[model samples]
Target: MRWFGFGFNAFGQIYVHDKLIKGECSDAVKQVKVISPTELASHVDRSDCCLKTDGQIRASWSRRASLHLGGDSCVCLGGFGAVIASESCGISMKETPGCKDAFISELYLTLAFPDRIESWDLQKKEKTPSWSMEIKTESSGPPLNLPLVPGGYIATKPPFYRPLSPQLKAKSLALSAEHAILLSASGAVYTWGLGSHGQLGHGDLTSEEQPRAVEALWGMPMSCVATGGWHSVCISDGGDLYVWGWNESGQLGLPSRGLRKAPQQQSSQQAATGDLYTWGWGDYGQLGHQTLISSDEPQLVEFFREQQMRVVDVVCGAWNTFAAVVKEEVACS
Candidate 1:
């Protein structure tokens, strides 16, 4: 698919498909659709593409364009905001009904595909927009190239929408894809979707509908977290390591044969003050436990202790755990 990037340059101008289009377009000439604040609870629908008001926060997205309100009571997407009017292609602020109290900062429009047109406005200091864009492009053919304001255009693709979790708040949050990691604001860790042998750390044999907090370390302050398709790991503020989920390959660092449906604290021998402990199923010694047995709880892998390492980060892949450890030096008299 062909992709294009467009937005405001240092010099405020509306560059469409890399070519300047509107210069100082009047406020009345534009129309913005404002979504009801109540609608925030509902799943964004593609039919709600337009913004009805000017200053009010609104959002719209399509295969070609994604719009967000700007801090200057203007609108911007895929680019910066507060464009000035000039002969080349500039945007200007003016009094309008949508933003009667504040001046209209900018208006952005995107044509991501042949038949898709999306637009919105940017208002000031609104971290979350009142509305969200609904992408509707769907076709087997390659994506389309749509023109944008300011400088570039974008190559659009068919929309990809995952159902919103009923348990999740209407606000913004992140989710894990295949091997990616997600750390929530709250230090608790959660994993889902796939758990071939127990990779999703819910401590059960089944997958989860949404994220569930890891209960074992509820009070422990977590600094970072990571997840694999069938395994998961987390680091505490005190530099301790905790693991759970799948352990078929000794990945859990334990000496048992089976999966752990709950987060288990690693044994003191397996977890020194700063040593990295692994547990789960260890088939290829991936758990560093030096054995090929499944562990139902956390265990210490002796090999990691000899190195006197302090783990800084841990990432889990489909079957491999990549850990970064800082080797500490012993002081001699």
Candidate 2:
């Protein structure tokens, strides 16, 4: 699991095995090992549930497991509890890392969580598992089958690992469709459902089915947070980047691309001005600001700040947005 890379690959996405043509910039950090041949690999333990979380999934290796199991099991499924994603196929969940186990999914009708959670699955495996029901868990785990299509989502995703809590430590989470944006451990940034489209930033649009607390990002500590179906993002460990909701299409690379019902616009997360920041929706630009327009607030994406580069990371797709920049011109002689 030691893979390093460098940038621009005219369609290889940045692949340079023997270097037949990786296209651009292998200027350094090159070491991409590959062995290939995985059997049923598909596990997501809260790598933001597979789209937006911490990390962990370096080399799952388990056509049927034998020598690549990072025990302590595996936690961090959806965040704040309860998860079972699997749109169709690609499943691999079984890591009860911390405790409070019991997930049971397949046809729905078995979801009971009082606390102590952690789960996975999202896509592939829907033969006839119908009959939906949420809120049932007392201690169950044998009657399973739902691995990717119950509320887990998967158009394409891979990478997860989050759930270590030294003391309420969550860090980030952002599910969006109805609403969700949690960030624990001390950065504070919770939210609930159906905020009409303000995306629960709390400026308005109303609707707090639970979760609460986004009181203007309260105390500003946020390490990272993302959600874009309406809008809501966070990144203030000094990196700044605090967006709001629904921009129509500019996706929050704001300057105002319409859809401003007047409410969520508080700004001032403070410090470190530019690294990455997008908005609600950007027709196709996905808020990268190439065009397509659709913004609400938080905007700043100068193609990685015109090349000085620093964007540590950021991912959002309900419309498209992904960043991971690095080169601040790193030299050395």
Best by TM-score: 1
Candidate 2: list runs displaced more than 4 Å: 1-123, 126-161, 175-182, 185-225, 228-241, 244-250, 256-317, 320-333
lDDT of 1 by residue, 1-333 (tens): 111111112221111212212443344122111111111112222222222222122112211112223343322222233221211112222211122111111233222222333323333333332222434544543332222211222211222223434333222222233322234445655454655556565566676655565566778767766544455677888989877665555555554444555665545453456565555544433455545454655556454456565555443322223344556667999
lDDT digits (tens) for residues 82-166 of candidate 2: 2223221322334233322222222121111233222333232434222222434325333211121222321112222222223
* Residue 108 lDDT in candidate 1: 30
Candidate 2 local distance difference test against the native: 0.43
Q: Deviation in angstroms for 128 in model 2?
A: 11
- Kindly report the root-mean-square deviation of model 1 from the true structure over all alpha carbons: 20.4
RMSD of each: 20.4, 18.9
Model 1 CA lDDT for position 116 = 33
Worst 10 residues of 2 by lDDT: 58-67
Best by lDDT: 2
